[model samples]
Target: MRVTPQPVRRQVEERLREAIITSRFMPGEHLSDRMLGDVFGVSRGVIREAVRLLEAEGLIKVVPNRGPFVAFLSAAEATQVYEVRAVLEALAGQGFAERASTEEIAELREVFEELAATRPGTDRMVLLNLKRRFYGVMLRGCRNAYVARMLDQLLNRNSQLRATTLSDPKRLPQTIAEIRRIVEAIERRDPGAAWAACREHVHQAAQVALRILNQQARDEAAQGLEVALD
Candidate 1:
């Protein structure tokens, strides 16, 4: 059986999405359709489609007379994202613990091991991709379509902040430990433990990420003040 090729439109969209998530495009920076088309070697129409998709996903925003720009997230806004994601992911964890087959659990463990092995110096995109792979297994095995969909959306928004969050030397080890607890809980087939671990991991990440975001915000504000006064 021949596998169907992925659509070019989706391909362009995914590339653009990854670029934004990895901070190749800084937050609040203008996005020119012609520039993106040239960069991606795609047509303006394809770039527009990709931009529209990102805009719908909340990763990009289109303003009247301003075209498109990367969406900027404040720490307070990111907290809302983390809060919603934590609850949904905890539910997914509980479902996975109760419902995943042995094979699925093994697959999840394999992904977890790979994620655990990633060094602190790993490329941000590579680390985030591995994390997404781990969650892809868990979300599928959980067998809850709605929860999976909701959590995936939130994760997309969270990825930019998370990549920045991981740049802090203190976060990587703690992140790995929190994930270890999640894996162990799932292995024990304890829904409560799985939920607890998942929740704790998400909240811990939120705290670390928020600290980074707040500092960046303050720094930007100070720079803006200095520029205005000059």
Candidate 2:
């Protein structure tokens, strides 16, 4: 039996999980216990516990006799997840618009202001964190626990797909603008406008992901043909 601190294991696991979701660790990349332990300065047992947590979250896979690898979503699965997320977030946006107070709306607006003012040189992790906070504020306006939980799960999954889309220069400005529109609608207490903005935003993101997937498939096919010719 390997001895390790539970807190260290939990922290390392959470950080690694975020890295995987952000594509810092690409899909199908092997996660070696020793390597991760060294990187995190933790015991192998701690790494194991952390890996187990990520596996439970469905963000990583631990195969029997094989190894742990970053999880990948199939094309169909990706589409399904995004579709469900669109509906869930739209509902949450509507609920937030309906229930948010003036102070709450002001707080969200402040967050948007900060997001907008941030420099372009900001890192992906920082941008991702800001995005999470922005949605978190909106979700808090939704008073229902069940809806909040479901929305959180959907968005958590979305962070994985979001990394690829972030590679596009056009997506950043477009996303910021779309989020600004949602914030504006929420501030106005217009549930219809807020819902519309949220749905349209998510649909646009899904379109971006589909485009990336198509490009990836094309690249793979080209590589395969080149290998066959050689």
lDDT scores for all predictions? 0.89, 0.82
Clashing pairs in 2: none
After superposition, candidate 1 runs with Cα above 4 Å error: none
Candidate 2 lDDT over residue span 44-110, tens digit each: 8889898987787677888889889987766677798889988888998899999987888888888
Error of 2 at 10 (Å): 2.5
Question: Residue 227's C-alpha lDDT in candidate 2?
Answer: 100
TM-score of 1: 0.93
- The regions of model 2 sitting more than 4 angstroms off are 1-6, 118-122
lDDT (Cα, tens digit) per residue for candidate 1, span 142-187: 9999999999888988788888666556788888888889889999
Clashing pairs in 1: none
Say which candidate scores most in TM-score: 1
- Summed over model 1, clashes come to 0
